[model samples]
Structure formats: C-alpha cells, structure tokens
Target: MKTEFTDIAVIGGGPAGLAAALEAKRAGVKRVVVLERDVELGGILRQCIHDGFGIHRFKKRMSGNEYAQAFIDETEKSDIKAYADTTALELTADRKIYACNSRDGMLEIRAGAVIMTTGCRERTASQALIYGERPAGALTAGAVQRYINIDGYLPGKRAVVLGSGDIGLIMARRMTLEGIEVEGVYEVMSSPGGLTRNIVQCLDDYGIPLHLSATVTKIEGRDRVRAVTVAKTDGSRRPIAGTERVVECDLLVLAVGLIPENELLIKAGAEIDPRTKGAVLNDRFETSLSGIFAAGNAAAVFDLVDYVSVSGEIAARGAVEFLRENTSDKNTENASGGADGYVPVIAGENINFVIPQRVRKGAARDLAFFMRVKTSAPRAELRCLCDGAVAEKKVCRYIAPPEMLSMTPCCAAEREIKIDAVNE
Candidate 1:
C-alpha cells in the first residue's frame, strides 16, 4: 500500500465535499485531498437536469449540473488534489483513510482532519416492502433520472411512482416531458412529501394526480413490471382493507426516502444520531470522534443543496480549528459538560429532528439549526428553551414536515437546550 499524509482528507467529491475542500484550502490547509468514487467530481447532480437549484446561494435559479459545475471549476483552479474514481474503503476514528483507485493501487492516507460528505442513497423496492417478483422495470427514482437524463433512454412508456418526495415529483414531470405516461404518485402520508412549488410545477401543472394516504402494496409481473396494487391507508399508515386498487404500468419508481451513507462512520465507532441517522454533531459540524466531521446528506438528508454546501464549509472550518489547536479525540470527549464543554440539544414537541444535536456553551458565533416539524400547522411558533426558559422564539405563518426550517437562535445553555414548534 502507498502511504500519504495530508493536512485534510475529504471523502466524496459531491457538492458538500467540494465545498469542504475549497474552504479548507482557503483556511490555509496546505495539503488537502478529495477522494471521489465516481469517474468525475460532480455527484448525483450530474444526473439532475432540472432548474430549481442555487436560488438561495447564488440568487439565481440554476440547474443542478450548473450549480455543481461552478464549484467544480473553482476546485480545478485551486491547489487541492482530487482523485477521481477513488473509493475510500475504510475510515478509522484516529484519522486514517484506506482508499484505492485504478491509478493509485491500495493507498493509505493519514489526515489531520477528515470530512465525510458521502451523501445519501435512495430507498429501493425491497426496502420499501413492495412485494412480488423482482422485475427488470422496477427501479428507483434516481435510476430512472439517470436513464433518461444521462443515458438518453426511457425505462418505460408508463410509470407509477410510489412516493411523493421531491425526486418522485420531479421524475413525474421529467417522464411526462420525455413522452412517458405517468399514472400517478402515491404517498402513505396525508400531506405531500415535497415542496409546494414542486407539486405546483411538476404534478399539478403537468396534469399528474397525487394520491395522498395511499401506497403501493404489491407488484405483479414475471420479468417486467406490469401492474401494482395501491391502497388507501388510515391515520396510522396501515392500508385500509377495502381500498385496494390495481394500477397498470410498465415501470415502478420508488422514491420512498433517503438514508445517509454512514456505514463508515458507524464502523469507525463515531456516535450516531437516531433522529437524523447521521452523526452526533456539535455546532461546528464536528462529530463526537473529534477531527472528523460530517456534512451534507451524510450528516442529514437536507431539502436544499445550498444548505448542504453550507454544512461542508462549517465542517471544514471546524476541521481547520481542530488542526490549529492540535487537539485529540480524548481531550474533546473528556470536556463535554465542563465550563467550556458542550450541552445537549433536545427535540421537543412537534419537532422531528434538529441538526447539530449539541452545542458548545461558549461558542463564538450563533449557530444555525436545520430542522423539520412533526406535523403541519398554519400558525406556529418555533422556540428555543434553555433550562426551561424561552431563550429564543420565532413566529411562522405556516410550518410543515416537508418544509425544513433554518433558525439561528441564541443557545448558550450550560446544561441542556430544547427546540420546540407548537401551533399558535
């Protein structure tokens, strides 16, 4: 194995990784390296051709490819070394990365700080529990997107989407534009899973029907998908006994949800957050393992790419600070709850989850928390409580599970803090 050393090593070269690497370089990290598993730097954005991106970051509506390309171009001009088609096989908690690529055989990279931006993966048919024969036409929403946008071929003439998430909604519109007939989009939840604009542009404007409180129960086909049984569900999401109906379609696209690709984090013995299914991060995006940070979908499945990039920069800044301070995981872990230690950030009523599950008491700057609500409320108030006292509060006209809220509240609690969203 070839051994190398760097100031920082970043895994995954998607938007988050790119942003992290760039920020680290700007922060004066001399030897920064980025490892990408794909043949190119742009990650899933390469397959996303739609134009609803970069509105927050760039003040213009840009396509995914365009947004990613802007960062890619900047990285090319920087001194950072990026290895394409390189796969990181193992990541140790002590800051060792075992990776391999075609050009560089088996390689070992020792980094002072490591950032994970491995992103997230879509839930497929088997994971979604749509039973039947595994057919060729059954694929995830991402697969269909690549097949049409990149490979230039339609999977089928007619399709049935099993989820109402953003990807499913976008694919419905994409397929319609590609001359494919979209039967409908089904969701077990009563409310739409995607943003309201997506529903307006992708489904409603395109004459596509969205079936709420319904899901595909079974698939029927021998070699290719021919039909699926969809049924209405009760409040608990259990299918109603008499609400089953068969919908005929050659393709079934499952966009049920996304899971962060954090197997390496788990293997490295880093603390995991059950709510976000990522890492137990502090305000700096630093994981419990110290020197190791997580960003983007690898941290949590963010609704916007702009937030993903912002997370990368935050993690990079944390990594830079860790390098400058020359701290170890032992020192960091032992300091929790001390005068300058971290405090627990809890999720209260009507709140699904919050990023940066904890925060340092003496943090220099305000921390922006990204969170989703448990249910929809027309008039709601988001609050931050420290030691049972309301420290910060924001009133919202409307709040919903599908819409992720970003708040930068004053949180300098000594022991614990709670985030709550309640109907007004």
Candidate 2:
C-alpha cells in the first residue's frame, strides 16, 4: 500500500468537490487533493447538456458542462492535485482515506482535514414501490439523460415521467426535442417538485401536461414497459380508488427523489440528522466529528448549483480554520456566556429543516442559514428567535416546500436559536 499526505483531502470531484479544492487553495491551504470516481472531474453535470445553469454564479445562462468547466479550468491551472478514476473506498473520522486508482494500487491518504462532496444518488424504481416485474425500459431520469445526451441514443419512442423533479422536467423537454413522445409528467404531491422556471420552459412552452397529485401505481409488461397505471393521490399521498388510468408508453422514468451519498461518513462514526439525511453540522459546515466537513447535496439537497458551489466554499473555509487552530475543540467556550460555546438551532412552525443545526458562539463572520418550509404560503415571515426573543425577521411574498430559503441575518452570540416560517 502506498502512503501519501495532504492538508485537505476532498472526496468526489464533482461540482462541490472541485469548488472546495479551489477555495482551499485560495485560502492558502497547501497540498490540497481531490479524489474522483469518474475518469474526469465533472460529475453528473457532464451529461447535463441543457442550459439555464450559472445564471447566478456567472451572471449568464450556461449549460451544465460549461458551468463545471469554469471550475475545472481553474483547478487544472493550480497546483492542487486531482486524481481521476480514483475511488475513496473508506474514510475514517480522524481524516484518513483509503482510496484506489488504476495507477496507484491500494493507497492510504492522511489528510489534516477531510471534505465530503460525494453528492446524491437518484431513487431507483424498486424504491418507488411500483408493482410490476422489472422491465428493461424502466429506468431513472438520469439514465435516460445519459442515454440520449451522452450516448446519442434514444431509449424509447414514448415515455411517462413519474415525477416532476427538475431532471424529469428537463428530460421531458429533451425527449420531445429528440422526436420521442413524452406522454406527460405525474407528480404525487399537490405542487410541482421543480422550480417555476422549469415548469414554464420545459412543460408549458413544450405543451407537456403536468398532472399534480398523481402517481404511477403499477407497471405492466414483462420484457419492456408497455403501459403504466397512474392514479390520483389523496392528502396522504396514497393512490385513490376508482381514479386509475392506463397510459401506454415504452418507458417509465423515475425521478422520485435523491438521497445524500453519505454511507462513508455514517460508517466512520459521525452523527447524522434524520431531517436532512446528512451530518449534524455547525455554522462552519463542520460535522460532529471534528476535522470532517460535508457540503452541497451531501449536506442537504439545495435548489441551485450556485448554492452547491457556495456550500463547498464554506466547507473549505471551515477546513482551513480547523487546520490553523490545530485542534478538534468545537466546545471551546467564548467570552460570552453560552452553553459550552454553542447554540442549538431549532426548526419551528412551517419550517421543515435547517442547515447549521448549531452555531459556534462568538464567531465574528456572518453565517448563512439554508432551510425548507413544510408547506406553501402566499405571504410569510421568516422569524429567528434567540432564547425566545426575536433576533431577526424577514418577510416573503411566497414560499413553498420545493423552494429552499436562505438567510444571513446578523450573527448572534451563543443563545438557543429557533427558526420559524409563519404564514401571514
């Protein structure tokens, strides 16, 4: 086994990993390294050829590949070492990584700090619980995307998208452009899962119908998908009786949802939050296991790629600070009278979950809090309470479960914090 060392070791060279590596270098962290499972740096973005990305980050509309390339170019020009086609098989809570590549057989990398940007994986057909024999035509929206965009092969002539996620909406448009008939998009929830822009450009402009509160209950055909039975869902999201309709199509694309790929972190004895399905993090993106950080989709699924990059930068900054401090003391008390120099954050009212579930006491820098609401509201107020006193508040014209909310209120010293989204 080969042994190596780095100041920071970033796992998964996707958008988050690349951005983290670059920011670590910018933060004066020497010997930053990135390990990528794919042969190239770009992750899923490589296959996403559609535009509408980078509108916030670069101030211009760009394709997924173009957005990834901007950071890849910067990474290539720097001294940061990136190992492509390398997979991190094991990660320890103490910042040790066991990885393997074609050139480096069975290697061990000891890093001062570790950043996990492993990204998220799509929910498969079996997980969606559609009663049917496994058919060849049944695949995830990502598979359909790779088949058409990367391999230049249309998977089917007629398709039924089972979810209204951003990927499903985009694929609906892509399949239609490629001469494939997209029958319709069915979402189980009352509201669309994707952004409003996607609903307009992908479905509205393309004349594709979006069936809300509907879901595919069954799949038919042994060899290939011949049709599917879609039914209206009630308030509980269960298929309603007497509302089943058969839609004939060769393909069934499942865009149900995504789960963070944090198996490595979980196995390494890190505390996980059931709400986000990620790690319990602080304002600096530092996990409960000190020196280990998680960002981007691995932390929680953000609505935009710009947010993913920003998360990576935040984790990188946290990693750099950890290295400078040379200690794993998250409990170091500040001069302010705080409980162990940390403030526990709570999600109240309409809020579903909030990142940075805790705040380090007396940190001078402002911290951005990202959260999602449990329900939709026309007029709402995002309220922040410190020890039951109103610390900050912001108003919103509209808020929904699908849209994530971000706030960078004035930083506060350690006090029990609670976030609430109240309907006006």
Candidate 3:
C-alpha cells in the first residue's frame, strides 16, 4: 500500500524503456523509475543471441544480448532507477501507475509523465486459426526459442514451420543446427514474409526448402505433431484442393507476426488508432492523455531495434518537456508535426494502409511512414500525391501484404495534402 512519486515512470525495461529512462534522466529529470516484469532488464533480446542486429546504428554486427548489455552498462552510470521483477498492472490517464514488485508487493506510483514501452508479444497458434489438434509439439517460434536457448530443452527432432517470418526462418536454421530436421517453411504469400536477408541466410544458405504461395490448409497429428497437411494456394489464398500434401514432422512452429501490447494503455483511456492497433499521438509522442507517452513496439512494431531505441529517446524527451512546460493551462492546444499542415485521404487504389494519416505541413523531420501495399507489385512505381502534387515516389520492385513498407518523407511545408497513389 506504499506510494511513490517521480518526474517520470517508465513501464517495461527493454531497449525502449532503457533508452527512455536514460534520456529523461539526461534531460534533467531527477526522479525516474524503470519497471520491468522480468528478473532482468532486457526484454526479448535476452534470449536472442544472434549477430544480425545493430548493422545500421552501430555500423557493426552485434548479438542481441550484446546490444542489450551495452544499453545496460550505459544506464548504470545514470540516475535512472531500475526495478526488476516489477509488473505494472494498471495505468491511469493522469500518469498514475499501479504496480507490483516481488520485493515491495503492491505499490502506487504517480509521475509527472509516464512512458509505456511494454513491447509486443509474439502471435500464438490460436492467432493463425490453424485447425490442428492441441499438442505439445506445436508452439510459437518465440516460445521454442526460449525453451531451447534460454531454458535449455529441445523443442522437437523433426519440425515443419508454418510461417516464413524472421523468427520462423531463424528457427528453421537453428533447429537444423541443433540436429533437428526442418522439412521446410510455408509462406502464404508469393513473397517471403521476413527480411530478405533471413530468406537468404536462414533458408537459402542452409538449403532449407521454402514454399511460397502456400499454407497449412489442414493440420494432422493426434497426441503430438506427427505430420501436417501443407497446400499451395491461388491468388485468392484459397487452397488448391489437389495441391495438398502431407508432411511428417514432430513439431510445428508458428512465427506469423507480433502485435503491440497496449492493454494497459487502452484501459487507461488512451485513444487507440485501429489502423496501427496503437495509440494515436501528437507530434510530441504524447497520447490524448496529456503527460502519457508511448514508444517502441508498444506504440507500433518497428522493422529494426535501432529505431526502437531512437523512438524511446524521443518519447522520454517528450515526457520531460511536458513536465517542464507545465502546460496544464494550454492542455487543449494541438501541435503540428509539419508547417504546411496536410490532410490524409487514401485513393481507392492498390494501397493497404498508411500511418500518421494526417501529415502536418512543414519541413520534413525524419518521419517514418509505415504501410502495407494492397497486393504484390513487381517493378511498379509507388507514388504519394499530396494536394495534386507528386510529393514522393519510389521504384518498388516488390510489395507483399505480409511485409511492412517504411517510406521516409522529404518535402517542404507545402506537402500538407491528402495522400493518393497507385502502382504503375
């Protein structure tokens, strides 16, 4: 029943929470507390020891644990408070957190600003609607990773992966290295669902087969995963009846996708964008609830961890500024991300969705556009039209519904108009 107060309270201690706490402390916020549910600060990166990360920001390759450790060391020198084994159970619109820690039990905390970096959760078998009998052999790719690498147990001897995303691809190769046989990965789309590098290194290099435009139409197995029914599909994603084939396997891993963890944010009266499944925020990263900021996977899924760290820093700065200005008087005042003030309208063309639908008019300031193309486009021109002018265009070689599209904005303030485009 104890209570505490701080200038900033950061939820979750992954890269995002770490970066946010460090940045806020550096910004002259004296009281900052970081709450993480795990015994350690690092989140999903702890079990991931692969070396494909940090190629962009570090300019060199580093393991996931290595990147996480670097951030830990950096935070050690700062005044940010780290609370491991602490879970935030509830968040209030007024930046109040109701949390519980193993050592301290239940506690109430109020902060001038709150930053949510709860991160995302891996999709489970239920999310895919795979009609397989409940079996221990079937598990999420992330779960299998923790069991083998962290918990030290083999998931299975022979496996068939249901998705071709990064996790599934990496596990497909990893299982092979662990003396397990990976039959192949089945992707529902024509193009692979993961990074191109993964498709090459994890599957192509290892000679693991990948079947595109295919899916698990029927799942077979009684007690455990003895086999599965894989089938090819047509353009409409309907399984071609005669193309079904049964493959023998002891395990089936689903690595379909990750969704943002925003339950607490939503319960706290935050306005969530149905598009991103995350909160809709202003330029400052502050949600409709003033003084509450969100970043990292909890806000929206990112392509790289480097961007996750950067977004964390920005959210912390936003939280600190919100406290400094004490803008309760101007709470209703809205800020524009750009100068020209742009509207967002989608053309009824081959475009799935777009992020930050409303682009504020002004100079471009490193805005990241997250989207998904309507269909597979090969050697097509992807253009963004703003107010009847060609604002941006890119030579798109391929686009898939499974893969996310990230485009950077580069325009003057006059680019504040509705976005309409078509694939040529």
Best by lDDT: 1
**What tens digits encode model 1's per-residue C-alpha lDDT throughout 1-424?**
8999999999999999999999999998899999999999988899989998898999999999999999999999999899999999999989999999988899999999999999999998888877888878899999999999999999998999989989999999999999999999999989888888999999999999999999999988999988999999999998999989999999999999999999999999989998899999988898889789999999999978999999999899988988877755555432344325877889887989999898887533567788999989899999988768887899999998877787887656777888999899
Model 2 scores a C-alpha lDDT of: 0.89
| TM-scores, each model vs. reference | 0.94, 0.94, 0.86
In model 2, residue pairs whose N, Cα or C atoms come closer than 3 Å (at least 3 residues apart or on different chains), thus clashing, are none
lDDT of 2 by residue, 1-424 (tens): 9999999999988888999999999998889999999899988889989997888899999999999999999999999899999999999978899999889899899999999999998999878888777788998999999999988999999999989989899999999999999999999989899888899999999899999999999999999999999999999999999999999999999999988889999999888899899898888898888789999999998868888898999999999988877755563432223337578889997899999888887655477788999988899999988778887899999998888887776667556778999999
Candidates 2 and 3 compared by TM-score, better number? 2
Clashes of each: 0, 0, 7
Q: After TM-score superposition, what is the CA distance of residue 187 in candidate 2 from its true location, in Å?
A: 1.4
Worst 10-residue lDDT window for candidate 3 reads 331-340
RMSD of 2: 2.5
lDDT comparing candidate 1 with the true structure: 0.90
Error of 2 at 297 (Å): 0.1
Q: Rank the candidates by lDDT, best first.
A: 1, 2, 3
Residue-level lDDT tens digits of model 3 in 1-424: 9799989999999999998998988888889999999999888889887887777678889988988998898888887888899889999988889999878899899998999999998887777767758866988888888888888889899888988888889888888888888999998877788878888999999899999999886567777888888899899777888998999888888888888899999999988877667787544566667789888888777657887887788789878878866845663223443323444435336666655445445555545555666666555666666556776778777766655555565554443433433556
